[model samples]
Target: MRIRQRCGERARKRADRGPSGLSLLPWLLMGLGALSHLLGGQAPNPWIGAAGLLAFNTVYIAIVFRAFDRSRRESPLTWGLLVTLGLLTFGLAIGYGREWLLLFPLLGLGVGAVVRRGRLLPLIAFPLVVAVGAVTFWRDGWGSIGIVYGTFISIMVTAAILALDETVRELRETREELARAAVEKERLRFSRDLHDLLGHTLSVIVVKSEVVRRLAPRDLDAALAQVADIESVGRQALTEIREAVTGYREGSLATELDRARDALSTAGIEPVVRRSGPLLAPQTEALLSWVVRESATNAVRHSGASRCEIALSGSADRVRLTVTDDGRGPADGTPGSGLRGLRERVAAAGGTLDSGPAPRGGFRVTAELPVEASVPPEGDPAR
Candidate 1:
């Protein structure tokens, strides 16, 4: 069983790999010649058989070699002549009682599996040749019944091995696809987190830098304080971004709300946040926090709105979060990169997010998460 399994594994690997046709043909021709010689009788008048064997082997070998040589420079004609010679050798082998000629079809099948690029002509031709050989053997009573049975088994086994090889190939392809998907998911997550971190921080820095520039000639103290605030905000942002980059960033709705308020305030926008939901599932909360940060950043950087509203609500089956700004809406009716990243993050958490111009001339982002966090019983805050 171990040997059979090992053979099957090797066959599968070979089928997955490409063929070396030139190298294979010589071995096949040599095997056919040896089989023919073995079955040739040793009688005194066996010169005719020997002569026929030698002529046929030489022709077959020449044809196979020519086929290999021309495969790079010639067309179907070379393969056609080689196959014809192979058929002639098959006939000679059977006529001389050469049971080893059975290797032809087996080798053909193996070669077909190796060179899987083109149409399956070799595969079909080999099986048909084997069928023809079997019929001839039955008719001529050349070999014993056991030989016929063995031939049938060999054909079946080859077919089974080829099928197994194809299955293994498909499985490998599936595994590769799954691995690619995993990598893509990680990339999306990293992009989303980076966007959220940098977008908010950069917007706040821009706003503070503008204030410092404008106030510098009028109020030196105020300008210096604003510059210091910028430095502090920049340091905090860098630390948080580093944590996110290192995969140590944890989500908290309260922390996100505070960050949102500070970011909007820096942009001279008032933020109103209302929360009435059950504590969210960790995944949902993480996604929602990203959405909050991204939406606030877009409002500060792109939307010219003066006020933004954030609301959260939950029920037994779902949770909903909405962020709205009373700023100038998108000119082209297209969500920007920040909003697009938010949508992807929400969708990955089995949620849906939509962002578009609100009817009242601002932008609106609404997301719904399907899973709800389990809440403790009333008055059981510790739980």
Candidate 2:
């Protein structure tokens, strides 16, 4: 059973890989009749006949082997060799009609291997077929269709199969490329989600834990409230991380703003939020929530701000969110991964994200979105 299965696997692989040079080599057996006549010593000019037979075999092997390589098959030298082989076939077939005429089909195999699908194919095939038919009729005195028909079939079938194999190889390559691109895209999404979820959640826990320590020395009830808030934040972080992993997470701006207020207040920065104008699409809300999460996290983590403000203004066509802090200004270097990921998310929704040092003092991050930002289909990461 094992031996049979392995044989079947090998056969499948060969079918996929298309024809090799060795596959055509077996057809050379057709020349055996001429070889027998030469060996038996019945024909005239026997020395020259042996040499001509040797030359024919050598040329045929070279043409068929080179045909398997695309560059060699299309070379000018291959065409030159093919033309030379055609002349040999005509000379032998016309000179010695009986067994040597089999060389015409061998010549047809050579022509099939060299010519690709184009005007050149029919141009070469038409005259070759017509000439072989005429020569066979003149010499064999009629009822000689077998050799002519074999030549035509050899040329056409070989070309058609090789053409199909080329197309199959190209389609296989294109599918592999698409699969790789999708894997990379999903990797980017998972990394961005983990960063946003952990970054803000950890910062909030740190700030409120400090507040609990300080207030415990003065007020028991207040300190316990802070600890309870810590538990709630931790549980919410767990749920959000689960959704992010499965690529089904959705965001609400109102929920994010409430969390931002608590995060900023616990960090000892006053939080002032203002909003006005039309309801937004789910995708637009999702993008704005990321902006708020990233901005509030940055204010708590980097800025020495005493107060931070988040503002949202919307019209029929567009909605914009801006976060500003009265603190030390944007961090000195390049934007971190959070800001970069948020920028990509916003841009994918037909929007923009910008962060820089505020003109008045501190830092500001701004995001704008089209009101009609379409929700990604279920289970797909937003764009």
Candidate 3:
């Protein structure tokens, strides 16, 4: 929410200022000398001069006012108006020759506001420079060199400033977009982690709780041992929930196998674990551990099986894990959210996850992963 507010405030600030017709309006004062010349009525046909002055102001106003809006600035109509402004500028300068020549700089301002690309700029700028140089030199001699230089400088400077302002605004908007995406991604990760953690942990707790209930009458000491196991599971659940919330939990393959063995035994299912090949990287183990945890929990909670097998094997660059159980199989013949989440994780690590009824009348889950999985950084809390 704070991020959204900050983004709104920045957008408002960007909107409130920058390249606008009103900013260019102050430069209209530059033409006041021409206005003064006309008002004084010192030279040439007064009515024609007045008409040219009025036309220049109108076109200049039209070009500048529309230049601040992106759609209007890039329109064919704006270019046509700009061309008319150019023709009027040259007409006034060539016709009046003295005070009227000041419109060249105003034309430069309008051109700078609209023309953004360097490639296209020369197409317009070069001809204007040439025309202004030829006319100013013809009318005012070498002393008017200042007018030509000022016109070019005005175009380049204004273009650079407005272009830079546009760039800054784009960068700010891009940054806000990235920040929002990151926040959303983190929220998704947290939700998935919480689900995976609580699902497996609670299943084990419930299984052990039932074991305590059954053993309490027959053997008090055995019931107390199961109660102690429940206490240990609860403590571990608290730690895992903390890690999940903080996004810093890492899992170990050996530790998960131990938990899976205990969990399956508590649920009265025999667990058989097999492993081969070299020791794997922690990242690869962490992902494989999630597979083991999810599969074992499903076996306990849903699969009414007497035996479950978890087999892990790896080569130089790849690893595989297969968990199978002699059970009735998924009632819907499809995986639950836990398996779906596991598929997303494995796929992100450049791996594959498959779950279905095995050919031999039981449920099976097979996961194949690269030896060094491309997992985002999060590891076992103990590590």
Which candidate achieves the best lDDT against the true structure? 3
Q: Summarize candidate 3's per-residue lDDT along 35-101 as a digit string, tens digits.
A: 8887887748878888988988998999888987889999999999999989988988888787877
RMSD each, Å: 8.9, 3.4, 3.4
TM-score of 3: 0.90
Each model's TM-score, in the order given? 0.67, 0.85, 0.90
Q: Please, what are the lDDT tens digits per residue for candidate 2 over residues 49-100?
A: 7888788888888998899888998898888889889888887777767788
Q: Write the per-residue lDDT of candidate 1 for residues 1-383, one digit (tens) a residue.
A: 99999999999787665233344344455355444455654323356556655665555445444432325314565556455655655665556544445445433433333333335644665575566567556545665444444444444554455446556667989998989987676666667667678878888899989988999999999999989989988998888877866666766778888989987987799999999957666666766777788888888888889999999998877999899999886767798877776665566556789988887868999989876533112101111
Model 1 residue 62 CA deviation (Å) reads 12
Off by over 4 Å in 2: 1-18, 40-44, 374-383
- In model 2, state the lDDT of residue 42: 68
Candidate 2 C-alpha error for residue 53, in Å: 3.4
Residue 78 Cα positional deviation in candidate 3, in Å, after optimal superposition: 1.6
How accurate locally, in lDDT, is each candidate? 0.66, 0.85, 0.86
